[model samples]
Target: MGGLSPAKRLYQTIIHQYSRTINCNSSNHLAQRLIQEPISRIKTTLDSETVNKSGDENLEFSWDSLLTCVHHHSPPKAQLVLEWRLEKLLKEKEKNENLYSDLIHLCGKIHDPQTAMRVFTSMESNHGGKPSSNVLDALISAHLSSNNMVTALSIFETMQNSDDYKPTAHTYNLFISAFANLGNSKAMLAWYSAKIASGFLADLDAYGALILGSVKLKRFEDAEKFYGEMLEARIKPNAVVLHSMLVGFCEQKDLVKIRGFLKGVLEHKWRIDGYMAEKLIGFYCELKLVEEMEWVLVALTETNHNQDLDTVSQIHNGLIRFYAKLDRLDDMEYSVGRMLKQGASFRSHKDVENVLCSYFRAGAYDRLDVFLEFIKDSHELARSSYELLVAGYRRAGLCEKVDLVIKDLETQRKE
Candidate 1:
């Protein structure tokens, strides 16, 4: 069905593939299948035709693997499939707040808060279930996520007035974290104050929110103070808290602090994703701390299981950027060679352009020949490698040294 929407297509596929096993009239097991398994193994209990009824024969159908082949896709696409499935299942399931809450959270994640609100409102009247704090959080998250401020606040007011439920510390932390993300430090601190006034001792989560807010607002001192308080209270900082503080320190170019804390992070081997890897590497490069940069790279390499290719690529590109900015052609070539040796890629076209621009800017036409020859000799350049050399010269994407590049590029392409 090329004409059908992605979600609708998934629904039809599931209907055709597993119609014998699923009961649309029952919600609980269906909802569990939606979440607990990918679409491939959504059916926990199989049919007689699918499995051996007498338990004497091993069925060789491999329906699960076949379904996996049908449904295997990117995470967001899979989530969309689940969302449509949940929407249909919600109408059939009753007296299961857990499922309802989970579906509401998924709605929030997928940016369909209106549907989440519909699911929330339907919980008691239609499903005969009393909504729990989990449901409340999901409902609030859905509204806040969509920036439906007035409606979200109205829901909060209703929760406050409810005799059956009261807003908990976790609830307030949700608001705090939301405001922090929205870059509204004032509102974030207001929620933090409200949380404290409610007599709930601020925990790691609450402090993490405050520090994140402080960092977003560039109030480095405030972030430091919150971090210090967290340590004093003997609450171990999680990745978010530490990363936020580290980011603030980096922005201020506080190399001393980065050195001390990064040591601990490496010692504990906390995971660093691409963005964080880029930031740390670029920060060290700014300070001309090449030895420290190398140390960090080596450490990351040693703990490379946590480092994805994108993360490793960014690390290499950051060094390339530093060298390009300074016209350190020899050092840049050496860094690139080292990266190739380590099996990391120079995937960023911007970095490649930066290198070409540097060569042009420095008038190092002779050295550029060696650099180009060095890269071409690697024998693994992607398709755009020639375009950046040949097409770049033809289009003036790089200038002042085009003749030699063009000649060499044409020769390389022919051979």
Candidate 2:
């Protein structure tokens, strides 16, 4: 233990702490076991590796679990499971440069540049491992993720010094994306120029950066110009490119471009993310094109782009809200049933309130009661939602219905 490095000591400390607490809390036993089981397995595997000392580079040490900590969590915000395990990971005398690359990539993703650097430096110290192109890219990205441009570029310059790890188109895209996000068109173009001078034409990702930047800056014409050049390069526009184009057209209210873009989206079957679905649905709704909005849902199903449950729910909820705003009860009510049939339901309380309010405004009190009953079985009808209904009905002079809402709230409390 005295011979162990700080990273190794920390790893052992964590394992020891978890082991000691494994049986201490009876109420949280199941939860604690679920959390600690994998960690215990990791410790056991490491102990075995130490005993065997085979020094196999590819440790096969739960890549999925390691990478899972990266998603939807920033390092500063999360406990950073990756940071906790990754530095210790490199203490192993193995040359898993690829594994290290993935670790550093996750470090970049979580915006933990310090952990990224630790893992990178550990590569040479532990196993005399040389950095790969992927390693350098991830290292660069780790710095960029923290907006540490000086460090990122210094790393990029180091790449220029290494013949084995020079900048590729993807490396250029990293800088381009970082600058584009900063809205620094000058720096973005400079990187693009450098990419071209390096004898690498702009790839899909680089063009994506350019288009996305242009769209963000509201430079529709520049975005169109970049899109045209992308086409001239004989590169098929990806979902990101198409999404940017659609957003530009939507902003400009250029229906001709929108129609062409949507038609292309349908024909080419591009992936529509949740944001895209909401934007497209809201765009058409702004134009009062209800049929077009429904067609978007149909198009999603036909194109098999509705695989994400969240995105599907987003589309359905957007439509429900829009239909309520239009006071189209028949269509809105049918959509509610259809959303359930698709295994998506009213996930947002505000949307449910909008639906109830629509029914109330239309004087469909019987239908309102039916709708409440229909959803009550599945939806967690919040007390605040009941309060809202009572308030709405009371203002509309529906005394009896207000009493019913109060009763429902009381019943919910009892339940």
Candidate 3:
């Protein structure tokens, strides 16, 4: 035994390590002493009738102990013991009633999905026992977790057709959701549509998935169509569906349609809030559609006249900024005046600067004069406001007028 090769010595070291934990400890430097015997000797001892005598009580502890060794040892070192012990328990046991659920669950915990599938398949073939929903669900989820959608779909298709395996909406929804997660939105939509045509109405979750996917793909038309079909099928839209539609419309900058849809929600006595209105207003303003932005703001005030002040300010600031960006001096002035009339006077420095810049750039000398008269008479000049007027005079070929402003500033400072 001492004359054995180091490779054989390493194998013996592993077996002895496990034996120390499971059985009586002997300083059996079984390392060199046991090296001459075949590795199958240890494998056989693990799977022998002696261990099967206690049935699942002992099988559980044995398998659990064997698994720890299998994980700790390299594949070449533990392969014989792992395969032999698994085969022995599977073949020799009549049925493990108490361990069935646990074993089924264990199949999912195993890293190699193919091995888990083989174990489950073997259990079906030898025991002729039907797998439970929990077991099947675990198997489907396992395959999905591995991104093996083809195998997972095959299992789902079989389950749907089986008399014993009743497919619930959750089952279909889950399969659809897995495909959706893969960004196979078209396939996800087709599957549910096919199921519905076959007279199987998947739950709202399935439709919700389609809506979200369609929105993500920027297919607002498809999303809206699918939404209508859901409603027509008598599947009420949940908050997610409603929110998805709102966000989809917002992305498309369809403020008009969003307003109409939101109004419909309100007419049904659904709650409307300032945040939703802000989203609508912000979308239109981003598109620089001043008219549509105003329409949404008016609708908001009409729907909830006591709208939050902060929301009102956000909407007004957005409108001013939009017109100013386009250099629509008249439009910008009108929007600011309307906001002031609405008693919204906490002006944004940015909004004021934008208006001045637009006015200066527009080169409307008469309009610049009106602004100057307003500033002088009002006796209110933000530091930048005067700078804009000086720039405005220079651009209008009134350099003398600009110099006059500088002279006035010097006199005021001296005084």
Best by TM-score: 2
- For model 2, what is the alpha-carbon lDDT of residue 348? 76
Q: Estimate the TM-score of every prediction.
A: 0.64, 0.69, 0.45
lDDT of 2 by residue, 100-124 (tens): 8877877776667777777777676
Query: lDDT (CA) for every model shown?
Result: 0.68, 0.73, 0.61
The predicted structure with the larger TM-score, 2 or 3, is 2
lDDT winner: 2
Clashing pairs in 2: none
Q: Please state the error at residue 222 of candidate 2 in Å.
A: 3.2
- Model with the higher TM-score, candidate 1 or 3: 1
TM-score of 2: 0.69
Residue 1 miss distance in model 2 (angstroms): 36
Summarize candidate 1's per-residue lDDT along 108-162 as a digit string, tens digits. Answer: 6655665675566556554544566667777778777777655566556656766
Candidate 3 structure lDDT? 0.61
